[model samples]
Target: MTADEPTILATSAGYERGKYGIFDMRPGPIHHFAAELANAGEDAKFCFLHQAVGDPENWIGATYAAFAKTNYRASHLQLFPMPNHEDIRTHLLDQDVIWVNGGSVANLCAIWRVHGLDEILYEAWQAGVVLGGVSAGSICWHVGGSTDSYGPELRAFTDGLGWLPYSNGVHYDGEEQRRPMMHKLIGDGTLPDGYATDDGAGLVYRGTRMVEAVADREGPLAYELRRAADGSVTETPLPTRVLKYQ
Candidate 1:
C-alpha cells in the first residue's frame, strides 16, 4: 500500500496494553492511524523494526502474537549479528507500514549504517513506503533531536536519517528532561527548529512537509518549536486530530 508520495509519522507513543494477546499488548489508535496513512487494507503487511532494542527475539515473538489476534500479517527485520532477510530493501518496501520500536537511537543508527539500512530505508521512503515509529524510531527520521542514548542524561543527537529537515522531540510530556533539552538544542543551533510530541501523539509528514498532528486520545498533542532571534525558543501547540479507539 505504498503511496505516490513519501510519508513519515513520528511519535512519542508505542504499543499499549491489549485485552487480547499473548503479550497483552495491541496496536493503539496512533498505530491504526499509521496504517490508514499508508492506506493499508484489512490484512495489512506490517513489518516491525526493533534495531533500537538490539532486535530482541522476545519482543519479536510478542509482536507476532499480538498481530495474530487481528488481521495484520506481522513480520520483523532483525540486524543483531546479521540481517534476518536476504534483501532488506525489498522486505521493507513490501510492507504496508514499517513500525520501529524504541531504544538507543544512537546504536540503532550505527547498526543501520553498518548494514546499510539507513540508505535502504531512504529508498523505501522515496518509494512511498510508510515509515514511522515511536521514541528512537521517531527521532531517527529527523535532522536531530534530544536523546538519552548515551545514558540517563539527555543530549542533542545530530546524526539522524534526515528524511525530515527539522529536529524531533519524543516523550515531550512524559519525560521531564525531554522538552527543555530540545529547546536548548534548537536555541543553541545544535539542532534546527523542530516538532515535539507528547505521549500518545504524533506528527504526519508528506514529502518533508507536515500535514497534521494526530493523537490517540485527548490531552496528548504535538508542539512546534522555533528558535527566535534573541536565542529563545517558542513552543506553539498545534491542533491535534484525536482518533477514536477501536
Candidate 2:
C-alpha cells in the first residue's frame, strides 16, 4: 500500500531460455526465480512489457505465452502489442507478478518513468506482488545503473531506476575482455559495488534481502565493487568462478 515498502523480487538483468523453441511458452530461469508463484494462487497473472530496440510485438506473445504455461491462469497485462498504454501501476493492484523483458535499458527506463510504472511497481511490491525483469528489468533495479552494456560515451546518461543501492554489469564473465572495462568503471569511483553475472547466473534480492545468488552455467562469475565508507573496492569471485579456480 505504501511506496516505501520492500520489493517482492529484486533480480539481475540477463537472458533466460524458453521451452518448445517457443521462446515464450516455456519456463527457464524465471520459473525458478520465484517459488512463491509456483502453486495456483488467486488466478495470478504475469505481464511481460517490452520497450527496448526490438519490436514489442515480436517478444510480447512468446514471453507472455511462455509465462502463461506456469499452470497458473497466466495472461498478459494487455493482449495487444507491447509499449502498451495501459496503466501498469494500476494493473499491479490486481496482478501477482510482472516481468519486464530486456532490450534497451534507456528506452525501458524512459517509458517506465514516463508512465510512472516504477512508482506503481514499488507500491505493488509492498502489496506482495512479485516484480522482475530480464535484462533491462534487472539493470533498472540497480542503484548505479547498468553501465557496462551501454557504450562509453553514454555513461553520463546511464543512470538506472535507482531501485537497488548498488549498480550492476551483467554478462561480465561471458566476455573476458569485459574485466578491464568493469575494473575501469568501478575504479572510476562513480559506481559503488558492481556485480557481474554470467549468462545463466543471477542475484536475487527479496525486498532487500538477498536470498540467493545462483549460476546455471559452469559457475558464477566475479564481482568488482567499491565500499562506500573508504571507497575501497573488493573483487569477489562469483559462485561459478569460485568453484572453478578456487
Candidate 3:
C-alpha cells in the first residue's frame, strides 16, 4: 500500500545494465528504498510504464528481470499494442508503486494525454500511489524541465502532468547542458521555481511540498532553484540522506 498522502520520488536514478546478461538492467538499492517509501507491505504491487521509451522489448525484459527476485508482484502497462490491460485506470489505481522508464518526455506526455493516462495517473497519485522514475519519468511529474528528446541538444519542455507543481531538472550533474538550461528556463519565466537532481539523487515530495532529498549513492545531491529579481538564478543545495537497502 502507499502512503496516506501523495508521495513523489523524482530523480535521475534508475536501473543500470550489467555485463553478465545481455538485457540485465540491475535495479539498484534505490529500488528497495523506494518500495519502502511507498509503504508497500509483505506483497507489494508494482507497475512499470515504458511509454517514454516506446516500450522496447529488451528494456521490458530487463525491467521484469529486475523485479523477478523481489517480493513485489510486478506488471507493466504497454501502449504500443493497444494496451495490455483491459482497464488501465483500475490496474494503475490498484498499484502500490508505479515506476516509469526514461526516454522521450514529449512523446510520453503526448501519448498519455491521448489515452487519458494523465488523468488516470493523477487520480492514482491522489489515492496515494507512489509515482516516480528517472529522466522522463521524473520530468513527467513536474511542470516541465530540460529535455533532449527532440535531439542531442537540450530544449525547454513545459508539457508535464504537473503533479508536483514545479519544474524538475534530471541528471543535473551528469549532463553539462542541464544546469544552464534549467537556470535560463527559471530566469526567463519559462518555468517556475523548481528542483534539480544529480545522477543517483532524487527529490521527495509529499502533497506538492518538498519533504527532503535522497540519494542512492554518495556525492550526488539535489538542489532548489529560484529566480532573483535581476533575472538571475540562485541554487540552494538541499541536504540529501543517502538510502541503503534493508
- The superposed Cα distance between candidate 1 and the true structure at residue 184, in angstroms, equals 0.9
Per-residue error (Å), model 2, residue 48: 1.2
Once fitted onto the true fold, the runs of candidate 2 whose alpha carbons sit more than 4 angstroms away are 1-5, 8-25, 35-44, 77-87, 146-158, 221-224, 227-232, 238-246
Tell me how candidate 3 scores on lDDT.
0.88
TM-score of each: 0.96, 0.74, 0.96
- The Cα local distance difference test for each model comes to 0.88, 0.55, 0.88
Backbone clashes in model 2, listed as residue pairs: 24-62, 24-66, 25-66, 219-240, 220-240
In candidate 2, what are the lDDT values of residues 1-246, reduced to their tens digit? 122234433344333454545463455544444434323243446555666544445566766566554554454443224534466556666665676666667766776676677787677776766676655666777764444336643352247767666767665655565555555656666666657665556666656655456654455543545544454456776443211110
Candidate 3 local Cα displacement, residue 18, angstroms? 2.4
Which stretch of 10 consecutive residues in model 3 shows the poorest summed lDDT?
22-31
- Model 3 compared with the native: what TM-score? 0.96
Instruction: Write the residue-wise lDDT of candidate 3 on 89-116 in tens digits.
Output: 9999999889887999999999999999
CA error at residue 9 for candidate 2, angstroms: 4.3
Weakest lDDT window of 10 consecutive positions for candidate 1: 13-22
**What's the lDDT for residue 76 in model 1?**
92
lDDT (10s digit) by residue, model 1, range 1-246: 876589998998777776754378877787777777778865778899989999888889888876777887888999887888998888888988899999999998999999888898888888878888999999999987999999999988999988799999999999999989998999999999989999999999999999999888889999999999998999999999998867
Pairs with steric clashes in candidate 1: none
